[model samples]
Target chain A: MDNVASLMHGFSVALTTHHILLMMAGVLLGILVGVLPGLGAPNGVSLLLPLTFSMDPVSAIILLTSLYWGALFGGSTTSILFNIPGEPSSVATTFDGHPMAKQGRATEALSFAFLSAGFGAMAGVILITLLSGWVAKFALKFSSPEYFAVYFMTFASFIGLGGASPLKAIVSMGVGFALASIGMDSVSGNVRLTFEFDALLGGVSFLIAVIGLFGIGELIITMEEGLKFEGVQAKVRISDVLRTAAKLPRYWVALLRSSLIGIWMGITPGGPTAASFMSYAMAKRTSRNPAKFGKGEPEGVIAPETADHAAGSSAMLPMLALGIPGSATAAVMMGGLMIWGLNPGPTLFTDRPDFVWGLIASMYLGNVVAVIVVLATVPLFASILRIPFAIIGPIIVAICFIGAFTVASKSFDIWLALAFGVVGYLFKKLDYPIAPLVLAMVIGDKAEDAFRQSMIFSQGSLSIFWSNALVSTLMAIGVVLLLLPLVGMIAQRLRGRTAQSTV
Target chain B: MITRFWAESATAVATMAFGLIIVYGALEFGIGWDSSGPQPGAFPFYTGLLVALASLGTLALTIGRRIAGNAGLQESFLDAERFKRVASFFLPLLAFVVLSVTLGMYVATILYLVFAMRFQGGYGWLPSLATAFGAAAFFYLALEKFFQIGLLKGPLEPLLGL
Candidate 1:
């Protein structure tokens, strides 16, 4: 098909020395940020977006996208060695991974997680390459209602996950919506919060806010907690990865299921966190040995690592096909796309088939390259955690400060970074989930724009949200999903009542 | 004091208070100028209204849970030291804001970085000063020179004469 020829063209662009270098830089930085506790991939991508201004669109995307892949691989290392998850997706990995480390089987766990992540990521990329065109064509049929439904589903997933207190999650999300409103309303053209400042006229920079909230916030919280890594290092032999393959078939089902879930969630914009959580929950509930699930089960590690990678990889589909980002990191990638002066959507694919196909082909190559590099270097990175947190803490904070300033080249971002670092620390202290905050910050405005535009189309009627068959169907699903926590509560209450009646 | 009920309760009140203040702020600015062109107040006014509604709901939830004697809010959200640390960061941050408005981004950054690293983070003169200067220098060169983004013309901009 034409797809194969286009992929060949993509490889030609991706193989260029500059593109390869950019990919390498992105992957290296991504891994480093993922290994750190506070600064996740989204923050890391945002912090460095300013650098993309000078680069071609392909280079910008290669760098950021590689980082997304790198962070997925990187989060596993800390979870395996230190029992600390580098990002939310790695939380499941920690359950079994840390236990395996304590049992002197750290190498086995680490290798298992890495190989699965790499393999799953490769699978996701291949699927995206094959199916992105179809997905984009379908997306092109979407109107305002469908777009708003997509946003609603994505937002509701974050709030309805039952991770944080519902109120806190909603409040944090509301806070994001509020921050998003600070800018000039694209739909309404109102300047709500700028207060006459020209800088405010441009609206709050999502990039800047992300850096402050994730990057700087992490540093401040780390300083408060007192940076320290207390863990025993296992013998990280190079052969562990090779040895782990023998065990791969045992986790084959988890690998496949999580990868499927991840791919579905990612392309649908259900998000990496939801994908990881769903895969882990399903894996645990369905596992033969449910008792082994949470307390360091290998399946736990397999499921989430697989899902995170798949989600990270497939997230590219939306950017390539529809010009919409499925997640925050993808949004940042979209920014890079804009910087490259290469528009993303359906028309671009037709016009610049080389750019489109080359990217897809390059992703396949990049996946292979990333897996090999990560596996070979996992031991070296596991050793970095051995660095004292006191020192690491200061260095991270310094990097964050630099990252923030670089975002706008404005001192305002630096202050905002510190402010967010403090806010992050506060959020952590309160046990409020911070991911929703970050997610909300990234998508809040887009969701608002969709909502307001839909409103205007209906001339300010709420019925439009449910007027369309697809939108109504999606909204019904959303309502059911929102009731999940309440259903759990009811089930628990019924169980108690049954026991009381038995008495 | 660390009870979930109180925390939720207090947060509810704070939320309601903040929402009211925000709504009042919007009203003060003249809400929703729905001109043929986009108005400055429309988005904010709606947002302010939403905040007000959400907070009131939060308050109702808080009260309902408390009256029902549900103690499920046992998880302590904030640590004592967190507030103190927030104060430490916030002061320097506030200073950076004030300075940036007056002296522009580059100059304000130098002062914020030094103060934050040295005093706020409790680093010493050499390391903190060096860290701040190094960061600012790169930012100035990378953005101002490479990207062609002009910096605020403080004492330095006039001498360089563009």
Candidate 2:
């Protein structure tokens, strides 16, 4: 009952004439960024983050969240049209989307994708609306130790389940934590890593790091490919969209299953990319015509599209309800919340129901608006890909440098951005996971503070983490997850030895 | 010459060096448990130790792994053509930064665009100049006039009273 009432209030705020205009604008920019190769949602949001500093927090959040939705939709546009994934989450979409386009079913594939995305996002929003109250109530009981345990789980998940080597992931996260400790320590008032440089006093901003790592680093690689742009031309009719919408009901089972997979992954630390891949693989494995999966299967297109959007939207629930971001993009948004002087977590639900509800309402409205807007403008965005990459490459580079400078209006940040860009390029080349690094950088200081506070509460006793059942279970799960990778490797080795002996 | 293995090995060595440096620094702040509870350096101390051990493990595994076939111990980091292409953009980016500081942001952006389009993109001067000037004008209006944010201005801005 309260959720319904709050959602009604949320709709009132979100439907205002001015707020609606902001949503339209955010979604448009988001789609534009999403359609562009190499500029993903994280890079787009990071570049635009500094601009939100001047606006009211509520309005700013509406714009950013709407942008997120738009970007999620936009990534699919390129995948179906050009056989290129504009964002990582959309990679699975390309498996079937591009094949459909090659078979001259581009319009049908695109319409199916947009409709599935809309359904998935709405399903995710509904889940968030229902479970958010319970989550908030549960989280209200948490203390410093529980919060620290949650943070530990997030990092541990990345190490054990990130699909990368645990050593590489830990090394990357360690580097991020070390970088995070550069700024002034709030508790002790000591600066550790500045090394006496005046520019080092304020510490490194994650926005700069993001823009550098994703935006500029991506530009460098694009340049290495010789800055070429060539993609399939697209043309969609209104009838095509309607026809696909009608046919979409036949795939309701796939959509529902994918949404469920997406929501689970989003609520955990696995994130949208994992959800999309898992959903697509499941769809293939269970299909009557598995061989048709990568050869323009409509179910293949629908499955990943639904899962990606569902995962993207549901990822916000954890960020809002637990103060722990579930994905890289959510991590950046969490940094924005801190910048606006608002701490995320259960307290936010109680203290600022207006902001929380308004954001929720906007998600509902944003997806509806995005589906309509993106469906109508696919041709326009597809034409954008016709522009030469050499022309767009330098312009993006200029924007990155300017965006870095604008973060603090400091010239020093631009330099740091360039340095990080070089490091980012190397990391990518070496196949090291950058997401863990970004997450660790964002949460390192807070995690350390929580750990110290827990120790203080327990008078230096390590048992404080186990003093309560909730914290103990949480810590136990984190430890098991941390060790799971090593266990898996040993188990694999033993199996190999046994098989060799039998042979 | 660098192969995948050698590159990973180098990264491990660098990680170890960074870990040692951080651990050494944490020692200066004291890693002991004080009367209040844990000291400031306690957490960082553990983080540093983790980094050092992880890097050492990576180094050991990378060294022990055997290379197959005739690819040899070292693999070229990049083909000659790929290296050239990367350098072409990278050198320009560094120049963009240097020029932004001296020539101001707008001036640097315009010049960088024009130069890239002409030399790197193999385009005639007209379209290059038009796009360069147009982007600068758009940003000036959007960022400066509407957003009311001040950007780095060159001597030319005052001469034109921008």
Candidate 3:
């Protein structure tokens, strides 16, 4: 009942004309960013972040989150039409989406993708509404040890379940932590890692890193591939859209199962990309005609799209409630929260219910707006891909450098962005996961603060982590998650030895 | 041509050097914990150490794989054709950055767009010029006029000012 009342109040706060207009504009810009290659959800959000510096927190968040919803939908547009995924999460959509387009069922495939994605996003929002209150209240009892434990669990899960090599993951994460620890240390007021350079006073900005890595880095790869958008021209008819929407309820089972998978992954650290891939795999395994999966199957289009949007929306919960982002885009948003003079944690709910609940209510409204807007504007966005990459590519590069310059208006950041661009390209090519690095940079200082605070409480005794049951349980889970991969590898090797002996 | 083994090994070495640099910088501050708690350098010291050690592990793994005659590691990381494409794109981007600092961003934006669209893309001169000028104007109006943010400016803007 309390949650419902709070939601109603949130609706009132978010229902103004100003907020709705922002949602529409955000979704439109988001779709543009999504339609273009090399500009993803994270890069798009960061690009718009500087523009939002002057707005109120609620309006800012509403715009950013709406753009995210729009970007997810836009990513699917490219997948179905051009056989290229605009966003990493939409790669699975290409399997059946392009096939459907090739079969002249582009309208049906697109309608199914959009409708099911809306459904998944709604399910995720509902879950957030129901659980946010409990999570916030539970987190209010947390101390430094518990906070550190939460961060530990996040990083540990990323390593154990990230599917990246453990050594590379550690190096990536360590570099992030080291970069974050530059400049003045708040606890002791000592400048660490400056190397006597005056520009090191502010440390490396994560925004610069993001632009260089995801923006310029991605552009370089696209150039190397010599990408051309020879796409199927989608002629969407209202009747076809209506027919597809009508048939959507027939796949209620897949929708429900995928929503569960998406929500689970979103709350954990599997993120939207992982969630989409996993949901696609699950749908294939459970289908009666699994062989029809990559062959213009509607279920194939529906599964990954639903899971992608669901995970994208639900991942906001941990970022809002616990100050831990579940994805790179969410990490950028959390960085935005800090810049807005708002600390993301349990206190945010009590201190500013209007901001928290208003943002949540806006999520419900944003997805509805996204689905409708995307449905009406599919051809418009698809045509954007028809524009030559030569023109679009340089423009994107300019936007990236301009964005880097706007972050505190530093020329040094432009150089820094270029450096990170090279690093980003190398890292991507080498299969070193970039999410852990971004996540580490975002929370690195906070994790250090929590650890140092806990150490003070325990007088540097490491046993403080296990002093309380809550903290101990959190630490125990972290340890298990950290060791799970190693255990699996060892077990596999042992099984291989046994099989060899039997042979 | 570069093989995957060399690329992996070089990257490992670079990361290891980065980690060691951090470690050296961290040593300037006391890495030891005191009664007051952790020193300023303690956190970075450990993180740097972790990075260095993990990078060494990666290096070792790469060497072991190479020793085992891994076919995948022997594949070309970048062939000549791919290198040419990447270089053409990267060199202009490098020029754009240098111009952005010395010249203004707006000027660099126009020049870079023109070069890419006209010379590289083989578009007509009219369209390339239109796009180049249009992008600069749009950015100027949107960023400078609307957003009230000043971008990097050079000698040209001052002479043309009212």
Tens digits of per-residue lDDT, candidate 1, A1-503, equal 65676677788888988778777777777888898876788888886677777766666667777887788778888888888888877887888888988888888888888888887788788888788877777777767677778666665665576466666666666666666667566654555666566666655666776777776666666655555676658665777767777879977888899999999888766677778888989998998889987676888888888898898888888767866666768876675666567766776787777777767776776766677667767767777888555335544555566566666666566566666666665565565556555555555665666666776678767798799787898777777766776787799999999999999
Candidate 2 structure quality by residue, lDDT tens digits, A1-503: 99999999989878888888999999999999998866788888898989999898889988998888889988998888887788889999999999999888999999999999999999899999998877988999999999999999888988888888899889888888877777688678887766668898898888888898888887777777665545666788998889889999999899999999999888888889999999999999999989999999999999999999899999899889998888889989999998999989999999999989999999999899899889888989998888888888888899889988888888888889998898778778776788887888888888989999999999988899999899999999999989999999999999999999999
Q: Give the per-residue lDDT of model 3 (tens digit) for B81-150.
A: 9999999999999999999999888889999999999999999999999999999999999988898788
Clashing pairs in 3: none
CA displacement after TM-score superposition, residue B152 of candidate 2 (Å): 2.6
Give residue A442's error in model 2 in angstroms. 1.7
Per-candidate TM vs. native?
A: 0.84, 0.97, 0.99
Candidate number that wins on DockQ, 1 or 2: 2
lDDT per residue as tens, model 2, B37-134: 67777777778888888899888877766343435335665677888888898999999898887878899999999999998899999999999999
- Quick one: best lDDT, which candidate? 3
lDDT of 2 at A101: 91
Tell me the TM-score of model 3.
0.99
Give per-candidate clash totals.
10, 0, 0
Q: After superposition, how far is residue A145 of candidate 1 from its true place, in Å?
A: 2.7
Best-matching candidate per TM-score: 3
Each model's TM-score for chain A is: 0.89, 0.98, 0.99
Among these predictions, the greatest DockQ belongs to 3
What are the candidates' interface root-mean-square deviations?
5.0, 1.7, 0.9
In model 1, the runs with Cα more than 4 Å from the true position are A187-190, A196-199, A234-236, A290-297, A319-324, A335-348, A431-449, A452-456, A466-468, A483-499, B1-43, B67-162
